[model samples]
Target: MINTWPKNGRALYTRETVITAIRKTITAVGCVAALTAGAVACGTEQQLSPGKQLSNAFDAMGKQHSLSVEMGLDATPDQLIAMSKGSDEPMPPAMAKAMSKLKVTFSAQSKKALADTEQGDVTGSSMKISGGEGDLVEGRFIGDTVYYRVDLKAFAKMTGSPAPTKEDLDAKLPKGLGFADKILDGEWVKVDTKAMKKAAEKQSKANGGSGVTGGKDGKDGKDGKTPSGKPTLSEQSQKKILEELKGVVNHEVTIKDGGKHDGADHVVATAPFRTVLKSVFDKLRPFADEMSPGGAAKMPKEEDFKEIPDAKVSVDFALKKGKLSAASMDLAPLAEKAKIKGEVPLRMTFDDSADNVTAPANATAIDPEEMIAGAMSLASGARGATGHGGVHGADTSLYTG
Candidate 1:
């Protein structure tokens, strides 16, 4: 039998490592969060130029004190299947069918979150992921606490499992699933962000911040100061990003009057989607490499992006009363290779709005140690349950003799 946890129920990893791992997971999740209604980057038009407009609009959007963004995928299952046909190994029919019918949408409401460096700077923030079935997950950050919940019913249905009702948890949690009590009930669970940091600090100081995961010079990340003849990794990375983005922002992206959309001045930004994507990946690689300790971050070479079609993608922005309002993206061009017979639009809409993010009254306080233990237990057995699709006909059975 495999030992899931250290002896006497103690965690093998330090508090800092666990917290860092959690923080990283959350950040990854945030990146995939849906756009307002629809999302994508755009190209050039007119004397002012659409590229400049896109850049300016993006800058303005970032500077907003409060905002709401929502994004939804507007493609049917048949279109999704057609798009997958060109793949070396097309997605499983069952998976594609389920996903196409599944409406995946993301929305975030926030206040004072332009520069997310300090949590305190963000007075309130709420993010949620909902699907055709229902809400799968939700997260809120208010004050010094983080509140989140997982709708097990929605999650199970999305994952191809029989949806479980709250009654299951009301009586008793399933064996080995006690750590997910709040999640099963679709109730809020709160984490004291400051306490988490303090615990990590206490653990670090006890061992002089020289744990197994710490760097050779007794630090977690690079020193704050810039290296000789160079800017800091973050600063260099930001510059690299801006430089690469210029391809779409200053040249490739164009703007055309979309006329009136919902009684607002509509502008559409267009660009060659593939080229923009390639530029973004190319630019982000250096930064990823720099920030990732031991070169953990990796990016595909130019050849790997060959499959992506060179098609123009356009995003529509709606301005109401001379203020930045909402946006939507047209993604049909990108999937031309699939010969899809219908529209594939990803829509976006954002507005200056109040962020009503607040801490939940009956939120369950999660025990980090127990949460980690449960996570490890599930993780160890997950590989066998999953099918590594690259290998054809590979067994995906959860158990094998």
Candidate 2:
């Protein structure tokens, strides 16, 4: 049989992106922990090491709990602007004269994960954003990866109109595709740092960082000019550069302290939240600036991000057998009145084969790209029919594990 998933390509998103999802997944998984934490405290005598407890609790929960979670997303201004620019035909004078409009919403769901090994179900929604309504998108996660669906019509509806199918959607696919896929797969590509280093070095020298004789800090000047006819960095300046470089390169992360979250002690893992976006932009900016009508599209670098300050995930339970019973969980997104609101619902159940089993079969590897494309197409159509806008406004569903 054709593998249900692919095997050899890099995952669509980076570690950080996956981690973000994991953190979000925790909201739903937390419910199981909430109950189990109490049981765990009662079962253990000497204070358990926070880190060990985290490992142990998750282990237990994984064996016994499964949860259902959902989330909502709101589009950034850039996405809305891009959407409004899409059209089925070249704008006529009258239509061209009218300003384009757009808006958006986003969200997702996952069946039981962190709570238990018994597989569970998760479903959620998304929509195309515009001034009126948004498109709809949704998903289900059974094992290691998620299966998502999206509605494009709802996206079109956000602008107070029906979204065109096929052709019109295809026209807008190129630019919107990447963002859509990234959102669906919840990942971004890694950058080639080696290339970035070369670019950075060339740019630095071009900006007058070459050393020469009789320079302000180095060798004698030739014809009253440095070898590259540019000024070099002073020893202090270079030292400062080196110091700053050390901070970002090859930094190590370790958990040194344990803290309380949701009324229980847990280990804290810390690391730099770097991304490939920085390096990609760094290498391309020069070329983009030198050519093209777009005038070097301004892309945000990873460093431009501000730390979220309090993002965290906690382990409350561990199910050793991967057969969750009496497991309970409620991710905030899933708690919305539109979804399941009372007494955390039993969302999914998994077979023992999926529990604590590392290494999902390489043969069944998921194609994040395919998953994204399928989801966007589905979202486009769903939006058109429902007049919804984006994932945030889409309907939620329960599924079998």
Candidate 3:
């Protein structure tokens, strides 16, 4: 107590009290120092140029081996009606009625590894399209396969069909009517991965080795050999893309405080839709001419391009802990300007703690071959019905002039 008080003090504090006061003072100083350091760091980050920040963000994203992505469309009833009205063709009454009652938002999320870009298992995935009363459809993907469950009662109401059951879905169709026979029983429809792969391969072969895994001109090698794998852009090509993006976009940096994106610094890049689209169209003009009968004459002029309303496309990247943590793209401005009153938002988040995907048990397998055959049969029947000579062709005898 004697050491705690100065010589001038009338009353000396106890030794324990002095110790407590010293500890409290030290804690307060430490907290203030921490706050000052944090503020300094934040200011330093804010001072970074947007381009440099983008490069750092891209580098971080490239290093990530696993990520989760969420994408969705949000639309109100009025928006839906507006979109339908904007369409070239008149909306059917039934469809219009459905749209009027529809207050739905569709969303999907997937967690997957990016170690192998060509093929990676989706460890976990889910999609839900909810409206009026509840979810109209719900689906999940595990490993290489995806399964979806439809609300039969809701679907029946929309399609003006009687209440549907598993038996109704599995029922045998008329001999020539092969369209709906592939529909599976029960609530879930499981898509087979192996079958899908085989189908894709078959299609690739049929298309002269030019499919999803083919090269620029659609062929694999110079001599139209089977594709070894999908062609990846060269480093130079990637650099060129980055350069083009930087040229077109205007970038700005800002700090986000609190909420889901708390304490992270963000870099936002925005570009006018018309300008970007015009550049793309110009690059593709030569190819467009080759594909069209009138060549460049058939191409739309700059005035025509102007018909597309001016809008901005914004992309926001969030950086945290000196690394890129998440990014999002917003197309709302563009959509709104085009008189399309709906929004399609895409967001992706990176995580280093993700585990490998495991195949699900009790999943029902489906046959891709059977589905393809059924689709072809239906297509043939449609051609015939339309007077193109298939199944129910228009009677030429009745057209006697």
Candidate 4:
């Protein structure tokens, strides 16, 4: 139904955002490679340099009709806690005990071609946060809607909060009556992005906002401006980003042959931890400045990142029968800044996912305004309950997939 996973929206810090960062990083590398892929003298795939091979593999995955990516944490909860905390000192006993109960595995299936990242493109993805008994939370993105639900008791246990009883829902659902029990059962909820967009546009207009409202035509605008007036990355911005990232990709990121993994040919892409981040930031500063003329980029200074040592961050891409099958990255380097030392591996596997990413049937759709109304009703002692079937958005950020 509606995406109500703990708003952090990830099982591990590594699953979505980290993988997104990795994808963006690698996509920049592939962009630069695409520029040269045609011009370079053709050669056998085996003869290509590590960087070129990686670029080609990344490109090949992008060219697929549709793809799926599965990412998971291979470390124990204790290790995850240490890496997450980034502290040299031991975690408080209570905190460690509580965190250790979590399940860090997550999977996502998507229908978009990797390189077809243009705005307004219709892509679908589904994610599940695995738990010992079942999924703690899950969500699916189908076109302009997202469906999500959480196991109330499991989520409550994970967060160390009391599970919302049907009574809790009844308290807010004076008009809806005994409907809270069914909702608390974790029925799917969907949020219509189109509706959200319309509401946002109306609210923006009411507030005297001048930005273009995004829809079919306004998704991508001139000068990297989106409908919200926020800078949407343009091809040129990507080019600038690629220019900054190309050097490290070529010189620092190395690819080596790993004989076999999961019955597939594996290729490793390695780079220095601090080197890539610094270079990425350094090159991005000018373009970030260009976006909002005269304002300094809010990116961190070099000195601010001194905690991260120049450790190697290796990403392994797997090819099965010459097709991209899976990929994984070691996340230990990121945790080193926290004074934690150990391997924190996150693996992502790919597949054909077009037929699999369908929207769920019978999802209860709720608008954001209804959510606001519901919240106000709760605060006002539920006397002013709306006539609608009330289901407020769930704040399930502790484990988002």
Candidate 5:
């Protein structure tokens, strides 16, 4: 996350691992959230109402803050080393040859993040799988461009051929799921647990079955309602979930009744999303196919690697004096193929004391022309410093003879 405060003479560039995980989960299902409004089951149990607490928290998050985050996915050692080496285009031949002798374990980590308020950055890292060995693919964000370094020898060994040049990697990298913006706009909050369960049960009964059976689609057929007469999972269901979840969190806020915090209304807040998230997880276990039901992982035919299972997220918030003060996230277990596993972490904090914390600033709406211009300027500066004359932009290229 980058925060530039001219008045405070402060600039911070930080990557919150936990937040990255949460954002990724959010991104993974954000589209579904948009379709599923008012899908939560917020009971009227007051203190026991996890949904209510979550809603309160979401309400408190009314002021959008600029955020920039980087997530590093671990790839199989061999794959990492191979990918680090460059490639101008798909290297099927090299990949085939490398796969013939490939015996290295592989793992991959992919991150999807929101940035500068509106923009988004999605990055991944992995190790190569060849001869049971790998080289690392290292990268960092320099302005808008992400500069990466891959080992050529590692690539060749993994692919059973000489690795592609730095130019190759640069060309291919951008073509693969580059940073995205506005993919997760509109409203975001936890899925309502009660509503989800209730809906799922209704669908199960409506399906004319004693219990809910797992299938790619929510219901066995396209009649919308299940055979037992319960509503099946649909855009309508999801919308209801978000609405209830939002309300759940909002209820925990400890507003001073009239005071203010961070220039906005000073209502107290709590992150019931943590508890609510777990509930969602339980309810969602049976509906994965329906949530992001389509889209296969894209890859060059020759370099076809096994699919990496999706990651899970757990959110926890810290409340101080009845107000939501901080939030922390925990990631689900990683698949065996993924190098990085276990609880990755993320955090978000609100400092009411911050003098600069005023009315939320303008959303960093994207301007394509301006973005292009900005990229050009940074590229120009990088190229000039490299003394490469007219190499288009920066000489951050990793190459071999």
Candidate 6:
């Protein structure tokens, strides 16, 4: 077996390294929490209107201490192609193939009783670009730690790394990174959340302050300071934008099937693509001008916006037991823009019966820095082995000459 520690007695992992490895995961969960919080703040009033009822559902959802979320997306090949047309960068052939076969689904159940305490489990799978089915990865979060159970063979294949052995991990990894011993033994890898939080705080301080607030000039009123130093939307501004949207988009409300859906309410909203786009652009013109090269002179014309074919966006909301149970958005206009034959739909549903999340048992804690160092070591070893020499001997002629 490889030695876990080196002679230097220095730790291999650092707060920064661990934070970077899991930042994306944290952001994803944070977004869900933010959305729930927004709904609660926006819909706390007692009202019976259809819109108010929808808002009330969101409020209830926000109040739940624990809930489950399921999200899914399915795109046909044509729809995928249409989606790719929006990207400025060219998609590699392999990636394009993977996108064509893409079918993504994920679900999580989370609970938070205190600001410092939270827990959840996430699981998901996608179709592989190759002919085989993709492996499902599962993770559990408790307190400030996350434990992941991954299929080693599939992980190696996806990452283009050799299947890691216990010896390799022990020898190559630093003591902090050696948390992989459990993973090598076919168990989960534990990540330290406290370290991640510390790193995040350090990063914020280094970047000049908490990223959530603006300078003394009130550049960021609330919601958080944006990089552009522009003012965030105020409630008054938001209401005005909603009014504009109302003028452009049609709204409808209907009682959904009472028997099948447990007496839930449904709200359907639709808007003409061109009209909505124009209204949005008009609202954003000031900001765009500030950021654009030629300012107001280069502002896009209404005529230019009119080039898009007239199509519609449909958003559906379902409320049950005074809580938002499900929501969906369909943007069919973009398909027409790309001259494709299908629509891409996104959907999410909430379940409030989730049990409290718990940390995985017997998980080995690993330092983030150690994992990174181990990967680098493996890569370096591979490169050295492939140098311009046969296994039998090195050619001295090139170096001497």
Query: How does each model score on TM-score?
Result: 0.67, 0.25, 0.52, 0.66, 0.28, 0.50
Question: What lDDT would each prediction earn against the true structure?
Answer: 0.52, 0.33, 0.45, 0.54, 0.34, 0.46
Per-model tally of clashing residue pairs: 17, 78, 1, 10, 75, 1
| Residue 401 of model 5, lDDT score | 12
Residue lDDT tens for model 1, 82-190: 7667765454444444454433333344445563434456667777766556766678877777889876565445444344344433222225455476666678888
Give per-residue CA lDDT, model 2, range 1-401, as digits (tens). 00011133211222122224335434434423432333333333333354355446445545432232222223233322332233222222222112122222232233554443222343322222223323233333333333333443433233223333343334334344444433333232222333434444454456575432234554434443333223334566555544433333223222323444444343433322222223324444544423322335555445554322222222222223222222222222232222222332222222333222122122223334443444455555445423443233322101000
Query: Which candidate number maximizes lDDT?
Result: 4
Flag the better candidate by lDDT, 1 or 6: 1
lDDT tens digits by residue: candidate 4, 1-401: 12123334332221233334335434433332332332222323442664455456667766775665555555565665666564543444333443344333333333355576554554566666654446766788877787887676765554444565554556444354332444578788877877776666666556665334544464433444443335656788877676556554555555567767668776665667677667666777777755543234466787876875677766666777667776666666766545545666666566654455677778787765565445445544322222322335323311222
The lDDT of model 3 is 0.45
- Ten contiguous residues with the weakest lDDT in model 3: 392-401
Residue 303 CA displacement from its true place in model 3, Å:
11
Query: What digit string (tens of lDDT, one per residue) describes model 6 on residues 1-401?
Result: 11112334322222122223234223322333333233323332321345466556666765655566654444454565555575443333333333333222333343343222333322211111121226335676555667776555543443322455665455443456545666655577777867754554455557667532344563543544333254355666667655543333322112222223546676554445555556656765665534532345556688887555456555566777677787655544544546556555555677776655566577777765455455555544434334553122321110011
Candidate 5 regions off by >4 Å? Answer: 1-48, 60-312, 332-336, 339-342, 357-401
Report lDDT (Cα) of residue 18, candidate 2. Answer: 20
Clashing pairs in 4: 1-147, 1-148, 1-189, 1-190, 2-189, 5-396, 6-396, 6-397, 7-397, 86-338
> What are the runs in model 6 whose C-alpha is more than 4 Å off?
1-48, 85-135, 155-186, 196-264, 271-312, 372-401
TM-score, structure 4 vs. true? 0.66
> In candidate 2, where is summed lDDT lowest over 10 consecutive residues?
1-10
The alpha-carbon lDDT assigned to residue 248 of candidate 3 equals 31
Off by over 4 Å in 3: 1-66, 73-75, 89-149, 156-186, 199-229, 250-268, 280-307, 313-361, 382-401
How far off is residue 334 in model 5, in Å? Answer: 4.3
What ranges in model 2 sit over 4 Å off? 1-48, 69-135, 139-149, 157-162, 165-251, 256-258, 261-264, 274-401
lDDT tens string, model 3, 1-401? 11112234332222223234224323322322222222223333443465455565555544565544433333444544454454353344434344334332222223332433433433455555443435556666666677765554564355333443333323322243322322322245677677686787676568666554455555455654433443355666555544443333223112222223577877654445566556645644655423432345666688877655456555566778767666555434544434654463444455554443333455455566665654554445444433564333421110101
Residue pairs in collision within model 6 = 2-171
- lDDT per residue for candidate 5 within 362-381, as digits (tens), equals 33333343333334443454
